[model samples]
Target: MNQMALDKAAVLAEALPYIRQFSGKTVVIKYGGAAMAAADLKAAVMQDIALMKYVGMHPVVVHGGGPEVSSMARQMGIEPRFVDGLRVTDAETMAIAQMVLVGKTNREIVTHLCAQGVKAVGLSGQDAGLIRAVPHRHRSARTGEEVDLGFVGDVAAVDTAVLETLTTAGYVPVIAPIGLGPEGQPYNINADTVAGAIAAALKAEKLVLLTDVEGVRADRDDPGSLLSRVTVQEIREWMADGRLEGGMIPKLQCCITALEAGVNRVHIIDGRVPHSLLLEIFTHEGVGTMVVK
Candidate 1:
């Protein structure tokens, strides 16, 4: 055989054990940012997920559509507002979010998966009360007082029954992170938090976050400083010391939450690379950081 053929054989051979170990196991993937907007990358992501299902692994996708929501907001003449990096959502903003997340982004992913011959069902957090949420409270930066983020919610619980049913039937559940309150009111949720909650609730084998960056870096800017593996305890220490600051805090918190709630492994991988999902899952030198308990 030629070198190219030998390389392909070796790649498949390396994935053999991982495929066997992951077969029938559940994986929750949080998708968003640059990866979602790029056409070629999105298709590659879908192909990876479809291959996962074909190899007998049950994979669930949770998507965020913040940019799409902002674009619609701009077109509608309502200037988008943010407080401490979180969208300061009002009733109208929440409506736009739900519409973009469920209507546009969710269906787009489902279509892609189906095009790959995968049974994919598009759903929202409000469907079947899948994600129960309460108003997310944030501290007022100016007054140091607790304030409510209009229509934004912190997930209280997840109904895993529907997910179980869909996955067991060999369908990939494409979830939109928009939750429903007890009174049937809709609330926008952070996609990472939503994915972590679902992974924990289902006790999923893996929680994969497709991020824009290349895993967690020790110096933030130095790619060579990327830490491939770290425990939740270490995460907490770095968080306290100021190394894991700003945007990284929330991501790490989600990972910690998943690990504490029983997820075996949580990965934050670069979403820019094509087939990054497969690279992170099936290879020895995974292209991301893995967080463990």
Candidate 2:
């Protein structure tokens, strides 16, 4: 056999044990970044999720479409605004977010999975109370005062009954990050936060976050400084010493929360890489940083 064919065989052999180990386990994936933006990466992600289902693992997708929302808002002559990195969602902005996230993004993901020969259902937090939301208050670092981000909310609770039913019936669930408020209002939520909460509620085997950058690194500038694995304690220390900052801080905090809430592992991987989800799950030398309890 040729070298290429031999390598394929080697890869399959390497994945066999992991496949068996995680068979029938649930994996929650936060789909975003370049993976959702690029056509090729989007196809690869859907393929990876389909392969996981075929191999006896349950895969749940939670997706974000912030750029898409902003683009749409701009087209409608509304300028998008942000405070403390969280979108300042007004009533009109919330409508656009819902239209983009639930109506457009969610259905597109479902269609992709269906094309891969899997049963896919698109849903939002409004469906079956899958997510209960409360207003997300942002404390401005510049002013040291609280700011109300209209229609921006945090996950208060996740009801997994619908999710449980869908997965048990061999269907993949694609969720948009729009949550339902106490007064039947819809709020825009962060997809990563939604993914973490869903994983916690389901007690998933893995909560995988697809990001634009490589996993956590000892030095942000050095690609070679990527830490293959880290523990909750180590993450706490980094946060304490100010080594972690910006968007990564919130993501790591989500990871730590998922770990403490009974998720077996959480991974921060570069979604820009083709088949990154498969590589992280099936390979011994994973392509991301994994967090553990």
TM-score of 1: 0.97
Candidate 2 Cα errors over 4 Å, as ranges: none
Clashing pairs in 1: none
Residue runs of model 1 more than 4 Å from their true location after superposition: 140-143
Q: Which ten residues in a row have the lowest lDDT in candidate 1?
A: 241-250
Model 1 per-residue lDDT tens digits across residues 52-147: 999999999999889999999999999998876688899999889988889998998999999999999999999988999999989965688987
Clashes of each: 0, 0
Best-fitting candidate, scored by lDDT: 2
**Residue-level lDDT tens digits of model 2 in 1-293:** 99999999999999999999999999999999999999999999999999999999999999999999999999999999988678999999999999999999999999999999999999999999999999987898579799988999999999999999999999999999999999999999988889999999999999999999999998877889999899999999988987877778778888987999999999999999999999999999888899888
Report the Cα lDDT for residue 8, model 1.
100
Looking at model 2, the pairs that clash are none
